[model samples]
Target chain A: MSDAASVQAVRATVGDSEFDRDTAPTRRAPGVYDIDLSAGWTILGAVNGGYLLAVLGRALADALPHGDPFTISAHYLTASKPGPAVVRTDVVRTGRTLSTGQASLFQYDDEGHEVERIRVLASYGDLDTLPDDVRTAAEPPAFPPMEHCFGPEDGPAPAAGTSAIADRLMLKLDPSTLGWALGAPSGKGEMRSWFGLADGRDADPFSLLLAVDALPPTAFEIGLSGWVPTVELTVHVRCRPAPGPLRVSITTRNLAGGFLEEDAEVWDSADRLVAQSRQLARVRLG
Target chain B: MSDAASVQAVRATVGDSEFDRDTAPTRRAPGVYDIDLSAGWTILGAVNGGYLLAVLGRALADALPHGDPFTISAHYLTASKPGPAVVRTDVVRTGRTLSTGQASLFQYDDEGHEVERIRVLASYGDLDTLPDDVRTAAEPPAFPPMEHCFGPEDGPAPAAGTSAIADRLMLKLDPSTLGWALGAPSGKGEMRSWFGLADGRDADPFSLLLAVDALPPTAFEIGLSGWVPTVELTVHVRCRPAPGPLRVSITTRNLAGGFLEEDAEVWDSADRLVAQSRQLARVRLG
Candidate 1:
């Protein structure tokens, strides 16, 4: 079959979920993939960092011998937008337990020049092979049931053409944490929420990448405004998550020199800690 | 002068501190460096991951236009021994605010084939240019003064040929957190300490890299023993640190499938948050 026809066949086989469709990468060569940056996942006109990571994670998963991405660290050099982009992956090392690689997402600029948007280093492994040992010192934060939280559809509607990401995912924020959106900033530098796909797709290791960064900047609760660009983000996927909405808690502990570090922990429906991430981002206050 | 002579001249200019001497890289070319990994910094016969990061960070700081590394994420592919290694850096992007780059530390294996030991991606920037705004939601962990805590020299001397890292730096563990060493595990999954160079050198961005990972793995406090090899480590240097011992706290919140995540925070003498790090590592229990 022709390359285009093969991609079409793969797309037909994928689930109807928007995440599956948008993050699906068509292999162009051994380590190159062509991905379409879907417009449905954006914050302030720029593609969401986690969503972009999911796209890169998909490409890495396809290129590497391993089936799951265990750890991924991405550096966002430039903001990316919705369009066609190419992801080039390089397998750095293929170990017995883990395979390591790097991927860079490139998009065409206004001058028709290919510019690098995001660079990522990830290690892929078989999550099923991990030892079934569990120990927890941190408990999942206390959060109300999904219905009691402030969901994406709960607040005053965002102006048209803004916050496209809200339409793509089911994000139910803790009502108390949404005071920032209601003109009464919490000043607590924390936001807790329940997250899942709107299309009822099961959350997997790949989608957990998106869940880690899907929340609004915790800085927003402290009354900081404007764009908060992530400089670096690192996520460790602990295990395959249970099928349900994930519980997520993000907090900004220190904001110094306009740069804040946000730490996120994701728990599966079984109350298992599935993923943890920390990101350094700039709070571009106007 | 020839390259060898130039390297010697450069070495002569470095401070007498072991950290400064060992981490100082000699540029072999525009983006290539030759470094000698000092034997003084080792834990359980393997080179410390943070010390290795410092070496790579030095190479990157030399190649990049920026002065200090603000963010660095490194994947430990293989454990490296003290010896000569080559670091090759690639300037990914040199933005006005931050210059991003990648560096790989390679060493010749026993089979005479060069093997990669560590791969790093870092962004360098001028800390002076950062805004003076400081708003912290997380306070430094409380601990006894440095002299009151359990200093490295206070404990039973490590049997000869073990823990070379102990002689290289001053580490005072919070007495309450050292129950694991006394056969009574804290079960808290936390380790707090005061860290500084034994040579009295003040900690900087580069040295802070080592300081972040200098403490014993928090798993030891929870009774999980044996080697804990870090799979991936990421450090965010928040600002220039004041000259004094740094207060550091590292905690493991969750451990699943023999893999654990440790989050560390470093506060400088001024009580300013200077750096934060999170690493994913395996708890190799025999």
Candidate 2:
């Protein structure tokens, strides 16, 4: 096929949202897909873990019969770069209420061998039919209005070649938690932020996957620096998100042995819990 | 082979502790093994999810070169009963720092069909070599002395066949969280307990898997009752536990559409964070 025809084939499967277009997966086989890692989604010269999760999630959602990802757990094996990649999915089980599966993202190396970047196990369900009885003991984090928060353009410019993701994601940090970016650190081990797509796309279940890990590592507030690489991340999509910027809060409860565990909760503009995640990462302190 | 000889072969592989013997997996092939699900570790007539995770963790640990499980995420597909089961492990990646793998627990039906009960993805590492730098912002829950807490024998007798696990694990609950059992729900969505093996085996990295999920569903304190089935659970083993009853606290922050998310933290007797877990379960409030 010609280059134009190939590009058209890929665009045909893309969804309406910018996130959808960027994370769109084109079916290559019965359970395999070809995806493009957008150049704008990198952090510290590597693709963001959460964006990679969404890319894998898109393939898992398409390969299975379900329409929504209920839970996704991914382990990052190696850093991935922008360009073409392959997603191979294996459906582990299909049930009436949920479907379980695994997807591995791979990038070819110099020797033309597939090198795995991430492996994920996820379960997908139809969220529209979920029961709506709400009982919440956790309240959304109180943050200043979006206008008062320090947004992407308001904060000190990130070091060059470090935060390309900021161009794709419009993140507004809680003023109190912004100390780490400056010379002072809060030592509180927590962070709160407003998360949204820079292209004005509303947060959805797939995008919430990105929003959960969108903020800077909570360890930054506790006086840790350098690139914190996520070893494992698990996100549970509780509800469909409302069409507005998400309220995100992350806390680092424990940091030991040069490792830390970060827990994150994302609430929709409607003040409902939409997603929750926990990740294990290495704290690179020089 | 004679029944006596078959039993001897299995006994040869069992470890020193009761937990080890109960969760031991006899290698069946390169990546497959046979495990006997002990009848004593049941809640609501089904095998405890955490116990089952340990069963899988054992197999994954044995299959890999690592000595400890760093993180384990499991998706419970169906109710697992106490009987003979099979564990199949697949190593996804082997790194110097961590080895990633997946394990699936399966049981046979009367018709001889293998049914998968739990699916797990985990990473194994050597905790001994982990850096000793410590920085923690989370503190252990302040409960009265262990003697003052409600031990298994002190609480109202659990319904027959409801909590067989209590017989195998000595769980002491904070008096305040025991209202759910005495006909007065706390409505606080939190539960704190001291966890230890009734058999007197000290908690290790393997058994810490069970300690994380051993607590009752935090939803029980918020006026929900019935067998809460865990849909997904992720446990991160932070550090090796000291030789004593581990302090555990679980809190349910959000419950919507009959679904809830529970976060648990386990601290060693020395007041060091040892393990942390989060689970998504269905709240059966009839």
Candidate 3:
């Protein structure tokens, strides 16, 4: 792709409308964000964590004193919905070589009450080889492709009958990486599928994580009809590894009381752990 | 001990009056809770993720429906401080048995603009045992007892001393079972320790998380002067392990542009991953 087209693609990815947050609608009318459950930007059900992550990327760009590639490493804290939220950020200490910052999130109610919260630590630095001690837990989980696992009859057909966002990418998961438990008898129960985004897009770590995070937890866990708005999704990039068909493994760890939580971890096609994700969802029983 | 004496002792251990916060001249009409940058809360640093975790636990309880146990398992999303922050939560489905939710936190300006956002997922459930396929990656980190770690020389000694709260039925950690990575290089960076509380406190999962989250992050990571107000802290609990001494590790991942971010993880002393944490801070840097 030409440089212009690449730039355009990046723009197009972000240009898409943001999630229409029905619970915490963004209040721009008063030029102040009044976090009320009643109103907020609502991302359609199509919106996934990847989309929000992109939006967050843009927001971070705007927040940084000088726009720099701020790589998110870990998130320590956060809150639940149906309540008020709060966020915090701090600059550790900026040195000539490297700089770091942390941010936290919380949910609140209309009566000026806090509902839930999350915290994140981020660092920006001149890319260099990290200390050898910084290694991932293990290679990615082993699983078949989304097609082999979910099959076409499973759920929505891929956007062009293709596995990844772009056609060329493929996730070559080594089945022996981690022993994976099979899905429930329903065939729709939680399952992990190894995936890889074709080159080009994979270079963008956020995009890779977005795709990893965007995979629906319900698809692997619960067979739900229609969209189950992901109330919240968190992604932690343990270490950025060479991108390819990164292994994306997901499982619905626990589910009850109308709410469910799923666990996900991303590993490179080479089997190195790249990122980790979890989603708390409101499943609509099909 | 007499009943009256027991009550007095308990109060002394978990005493609120021990805090000189109310008397601080810089803090007046302290919006329900005004934490001054100087003389912050004790545990870790007067102001660190632990304090915010304490506050967030209270917020989750307050926001719950009828304040049910609201056992929340949250994932850290992002962190930023000293200004507008955002946290998003997904109200996973609500059901009779268990429920799950997700949240994100962001820091923004007064104009309702997002400064940083942290996204997290949470789960609520009744305490029940599933076929526990429990295994941890590392044992909890070991450290001197809290008394030794935070002893008189560590900082201002808790007025009531260790014996004060010792009698209370709060969770007690057996550091032996916890996984720990002691800070190295003469501790050139942050520090982490693992702990498990005795199963004495309220069994409400949220309450338990709140108490554990209340530990100060600054305490683990050494070398810093003056107080820093915790803009916020978030907590995420995965599967609750047997309440015993759990490993808690903290590291100053990065610092930049007058902002800093820290990463923390909690593990059962046995080394099973309990919960992971991150914090975004705005430091005085004086």
> Which regions in candidate 1 have their CA more than 4 angstroms from the true location?
A1-14, A157-161, B1-14, B157-161
Error of 3 at B108 (Å): 19
Model 2 lDDT per residue over A1-286, tens place:
9997775455221256567887999998999999999988888778888899999999999999997999999989889999999999999899998898999999999999999999998989999988888888878888889887886577474543367888777788888998887868899889999998876778778898999888988888898888899999999999999877899999998889878988999999899989999999998755
lDDT of 3 by residue, B1-286 (tens): 8997676555321214332221122212211222222223333322223323333333333333322333332323233343223233344345454444433344456686654333332344443433344322234555666543432223332322433222222333322212121322222234444343232221223323434444433422333433443332334454454545454566553332333445455555344554544444444443
TM-score of every model versus the real structure:
0.94, 0.93, 0.50
Q: What lDDT is reached at residue A279 by model 3?
A: 55
Candidate 2's C-alpha runs over 4 A off are A1-14, A159-162, B1-14, B159-162
List the candidates ranked by TM-score, beginning with the highest.
1, 2, 3
Give the docking tier of candidate 2: medium
Per-candidate local distance difference test: 0.88, 0.87, 0.40
Give the B-chain TM-score of model 2: 0.93
TM-score of the B chain in each candidate versus the native B chain: 0.93, 0.93, 0.50
Comparing 1 and 3 by DockQ, which wins?
1
List-wise, what DockQ does each model earn?
0.72, 0.70, 0.07
Error of 3 at B220 (Å): 11
**Worst 10-residue stretch by lDDT in candidate 2 chain A?**
A8-17
Q: Which sections of candidate 3 miss by over 4 Å? A: A1-45, A62-129, A144-189, A198-200, A222-226, B1-4, B8-48, B56-171, B174-206, B211-286
Cα deviation of A217 in candidate 2 (Å)?
A: 1.4
